[model samples]
Target chain A: MADEKPHCKVVLATNIAKSLLEEVQDGLAKIGRKPLLVGFLSSTDPAARVYAEWTGKTANENGFAFELREIDREELEDALLDANNDAAVDGIIVYYPIFGNRQDQYLQQIVSIDKDVEGLSHRYIFNMYQNIRFLDHANTKKSILPCTPLAVIKILEYLRIYNTILPYGNRLHGRTVTVINRSEVVGRPLAALLANDGACVYSVDINDVQQFTRGEGLRKRRHEVHEKPGWTLENCLPISDVVISGVPGDKYKVPANLLRDGAVCINFSSDRNFSPDVKEKASIYVPAIGKVTIVVLLRNLLRIVQNKIDAAAEASRENVSEAVQTSES
Target chain B: MADEKPHCKVVLATNIAKSLLEEVQDGLAKIGRKPLLVGFLSSTDPAARVYAEWTGKTANENGFAFELREIDREELEDALLDANNDAAVDGIIVYYPIFGNRQDQYLQQIVSIDKDVEGLSHRYIFNMYQNIRFLDHANTKKSILPCTPLAVIKILEYLRIYNTILPYGNRLHGRTVTVINRSEVVGRPLAALLANDGACVYSVDINDVQQFTRGEGLRKRRHEVHEKPGWTLENCLPISDVVISGVPGDKYKVPANLLRDGAVCINFSSDRNFSPDVKEKASIYVPAIGKVTIVVLLRNLLRIVQNKIDAAAEASRENVSEAVQTSES
Candidate 1:
C-alpha cells in the first residue's frame, strides 16, 4: 500500500490504533470519572442502526460503558432529556438520518450541550466555527467539534503532515487544499478547520460547475497598489499539494490529470470524488474507512466526556474553597 | 461613471435608498412597533467611533431612536448588560475594530442575542450560518444575521439578480461567486449566506496565496464509484457572474484580468481589490461607499429591532391569553 505509486501511500484503518491509544490515555488522565455513553438510534434508519452498533461495540472494547437505545422520533427528546439528566450518562449521540425531513437535526439540537458529544447543538457549532474563524484566538471554549471533521483532522495529524514543516518550508501552513464538497457535515467544517491550521482551502460544489470556464470578461480585480492575481481550480490545482474531497456520488470529481505527482488526497464520502488512477500519480491516498472513523469518533467522545468530568470537579472544588473561606472569615 | 466602460454600470449610494425605503415600510408593517437602537463604541478605536456616529446618524434619519455611547473596554460587558436589560432598546450594535487582541469579539459576544443587531454572539452566528446552510428551511428561527453580510444580501436584492434566472438558466443560484477575504465580519458570513442562497462561493485569501500552486504528491482518493474533479479560482472565476471582495488593505487582492467580462464586482473593503480600470471590463462595479453601506447597516438594524419587538408583543399576547384562561378555569 505504501508503494502504490511514485509518491502515493495508502493508509489503512489499523494504522490509527497508536493514536487512538494515546487519546485514551490522555482522556483517562483528564477525566477522573468513569464515562457512560448512550447512542440514540431510530428504528426507521437501518444505516443509523449499523453505525450505532459499531459505536457501541467500539465503546465497550475501549473500557467505556456504551448502550444503544431504540428510539422513536417522538420519544427522541424524552430520551435525550433522560440521558442528559442521568448522572451516569456522560455523553449522548443521536445517529443521523432520522426518517422525517429535518427530524435528525431537530432531535439533535435538543441534546444538551454538555452531553452533546456529537456537537449537534447550535452553541457547539457556533463556537467551533467561530474559533476557526478567529484563528483559534476567540475566547469561546468549544468542548467538542463534529466527529467527521475532527476525524479528518486526526487523520492528518496521524499522517504527520498537518502541522510539521518540511525541509523546504512547505507545510499545511501555506499549502493549498481543495475541498470538493461544501456539505455542512464534512466539507464546510473541514475547510474551516484546515484554514484555521493555516491551509489555503478552496471549496468546490458540483451544482455550480459551469462557472469555471474562461472567457473574455474574466479578470482579477486589481487595486491601485500591486498584488498577485486571484486563482481558479484550473490555475490552482497545478500548484496544489493536497486535495480533500467529501462529495458522495458515483462519479470522479477530481481528474488524475489535474493533480501533480506527490500530492495527497483524502476522501470522506460514499462515492469516489477522485479518479481511481489517481494512486498512480499521487503521494498518498486515504479513503474514508468506517472502522477508522469509528475509532476516531470514540476518541472524541472520550475526550469530551473526560473534559466535562474535569470541569465539574474543578467547579466543585471551587465551591468547597469558597465555603471554607467563608467559614475562615 | 456609467460611461467608463461599455458594460460596466456604477451603482451610486442613492440607488440603494428606494429598496431601503421599501424594506423599511415592509418591516414596519411586519414589526408593528417602534424601535430603539443603541450603538456602543470603545474610546480606544477612532475608526469605531466614526462608524458608530454614522450608524447613529442613519438611525435617527430613518425615524428610529438611536444613541451612540463611548465606553471604556472595562465597561463593555456592563454596557452590553444594560442594553440587554433595557426593555425599550430593541437593537444594540458594538462598533468593530476594538483595540487589544480579540477584545472586539469578546465584547461583541457579550451582546444579547435579541439585541445583537451586529450578530456578534455565538448564538446569532450559529443561527445565521445554520439558516444559510439549511437554505432557510431550518426551523431554528434567526433573529438577525451579521450586518455586513446581510447588507451584501440586500445589495443583491436591490440589483434584482440574486434569485432571478437568466435566459441561459444561470442565476446567482447556480453561479460561482468569489470572496476575496475570509474575515468573520464580512467574508465568512457572506460566503455562508451566498451558499445558503444556492451560489457556489469561492473564498480567496491574499496572505495565503502561495498555496494555490500545484506541486508533487497531489492525488484524489477514489471510492468504488467515481465523480467529477474539483476546481480552484482559475477555473472558477471564468464562469463566475459576481465577485464580492472584503480584503481591507491598500494592496490589490484581485486583479482585473482574472474576472470574466460582464461579471459584477462588489467591493466591501476599503481598498479596491479590483483595478480602477476594471470598470471597462466588468458589467457593474459597486464600491464600498460609506453612505450606501451605512444605509444597509441601518436597514438591517431596523429590521432586527422590529422583529424583536414583534416577538416580544407576541409573547406578551400569549402570556395574557394564558392568564385569562387560568382565571376562567
Candidate 2:
C-alpha cells in the first residue's frame, strides 16, 4: 500500500564500521534525511543482511538525522552493548559474518528490540511470529514479517494466483509455502509468520531433509540433511506451490523432476549462474539476496513507527499539560 | 498524565468474555476520557469490563457515549490478524488470566500491534520493553501498559520496596528475578519484561528448574518454583530473600526456620493465615489473591491508553481517512 512516494533516506549497514558506513552513508543522506549507518566485518554482514532493510531504510524521516558507527569483537559482548544503549542512537545497523562467537555475543548486545532497526532481536522476531502489532520497533513486528513476506502477498495478489485463498485481501491465508533453510533470519521466523498469517507452511533446512518422515499428522514432517537426492524432489515437489530457497549457493541443482508444475521459485542467493531448466519450469523467481530485502525492510520499519508514533506524542502532550496544571497549583 | 480531564474510546479482548471485568472496566470509564468499549468473546462478556470502564463510572458521569459487543471468535481473529487482515477495529484490549496458555497462539489472534490497545502483542511488548517509550496503535504513545502487570508494578513502586541502582536506574536492574510459571498473562511475559527493563530475570519453568544443576552456573541463579513442592522444605531449609508464591493451599509449609532474614514473601493463598512469628519476621507480606491486581489492572490499562491517546487519535483519524479513500475509490 505504501507506494511510489518519494523516500526520505535509505541506509545500508555492512560488516564494516560506523566510520566506513559514513563513507557510504552519503547515498542515503542525499535522500533528504540524516542517514544512520553501522558496519561490522565481512564475516558478519551476510547474517546482518536479513535485518538490514529496516535499519537501512525504516526510520523517522521528519527531523530524522543519524550517524554511522563500526564495532568489533570484545565490543560485541559487554562494551558495544553499552554503546548501543548509551549512544541514544535512533537506530542501529549491523553487518556481520553468518557465524561465530562474534555473531552470538553481538546478537546479545546488538540493542533493544525497540531500537533494533535490523530487527535481529530474538524477541522481536518471535513476536513477529506471534503476529501482534509492534509499535516502537521500526521494521520489526508482533509477527516476524519482513517486507519480503508481505511482498509475497502483494505479488500473489498482483499475479492473482487463482489457486490461493485470501482472507480479506490478506495474501498468506490459504496457500501452502514450503521454505528450505532453517537459519534464524529466514526459515523459522518466516514460517511462524506464515502460519500466523493462516497459511499451511512447511519449513525445513535443506541440509536435514534426508531424514524426512511422513508423520501421522496431516503434513509430512521431516528431518533436514543436505545432499539427499530424494529429499528435494520427493519432499517438496508434490506438496508446495511456492518453494523458497534461502541457501547461499548461486546455482542449486534441482532436477526438473523436483520442480512442481507451475511452482513459484524464490532464490535467496546471489549466484546468477542458476540453471535455466529450473526457472523455465517454475512460475516465478525472486532473488532475496539484495533486491527484495531492501524494500521489505523499509516497509516493515515504517509500519512499526507508524503504528505507535501518534500515541507517544499524545502521551507526552498529556504529561506536559499535567505538569503545567500542577505548576499552576 | 492522562488525567480525568481528557476523553478517549477503547476496546477490550480476552479468552474470557468482557463481562468478567465489569466492575473495574466501569471504573476505568469514569476516568478522564470519554470511552468506547469494544470486546471479543467466545461466550460471556469479557469485553463488557472494558465497556464498564469507558461507559462506567467516570465516562457515565461525563455523559460520554460507549458501545459494547461480543464478536464471533473467527470474525474477531480475522479482524485482528494480519494474515486475515480485517481492518475495521480501532483499539483492542485483553484481560489477564491468573493462569492459562503460554504458547501465545491465542494472543496472536488479536489485532495487529497497530490497533492493539494494551500493548499485549508479543512483538509490541518486546518492542515497548526496549525503548521504554509507549506507543499507540496509530499515532501517540504514552504510558499505556498491560493492566495486571502494571498493577503489580504500581504496588511495588507505590510501596517503594525496590531501591535505586547507580547507572541502570533502580535495584531491579540486573537483579535476578525468577518467575516459576509459563503464564502468558503474567508469569512468563512479565519476567521477560523485567529482564528487558534491565533486571537479570530468570524465567524458570518446572521443566527448567527441575532439570537445573545445583552448582556453578545455577549456584547463584534465582529459583522460582510454582509446582507444588514434591519434597517438603522441612528437609532443605536454606531460606531465600524474595519469595513470590502463587501456589495454592497450605499443604506446603514455610517453617519458621526456612525463611532468611529480611526476606519479603508474597503469598497468593492468604486464607491459611501465617503464624504471627512468620509474619512479624518478614520484611514484606503480599496477599496475592486480589488486592493489588484489581486496582493495578485498571490503572495500568489507563496508563497504556493515556500514554498514547494523542497518537491513537491521530491513528484513528488516519484510519477514517483511509476508509474514506476506500469508499471513494
Point to the candidate with the largest TM-score.
1
Interface DockQ per candidate: 0.06, 0.01
Tens-digit lDDT string for candidate 2 (B1-329): 11121111111122112233454566556565543434444334454454345433432333333234445544555534632253333344443331234433565445555445455666666554443444445544553455445544544433332332112322242123334444555665565445434343444443443211111112222322233345333322222334444433566444555553333444433343344355533434554524344334344444444544555677899999999999999
lDDT of 1 by residue, A1-329 (tens): 12112334677656765566667767766665557788888757677778888888877777778888887777778888888888888788888787556766677788887777776678777756544222124533435778888777777767654433211111233245677777778777776666545455666665431112111222221101111245445654655657777876676567778774445678887676777777765556787656667776667677666556556787899999999999999
Best by DockQ: 1
Span of 10 residues, lowest total lDDT, candidate 1 chain B: B219-228
Model 2's DockQ? 0.01
Candidate 2 positional error at B280, Å: 61
Predicted candidate 1 versus true structure: per-residue lDDT over B1-329, tens digit per residue: 01111324677646675567667767666665557788877756677777877777776766678888778867778988988998888788777666656776677777877677666678777765654322124533435666678777777666654533211111233245677787767787777666545455666664432112111221111101111145456765654657888777777656667666556688888777677777755656787756666666566676566555556787999999999999999
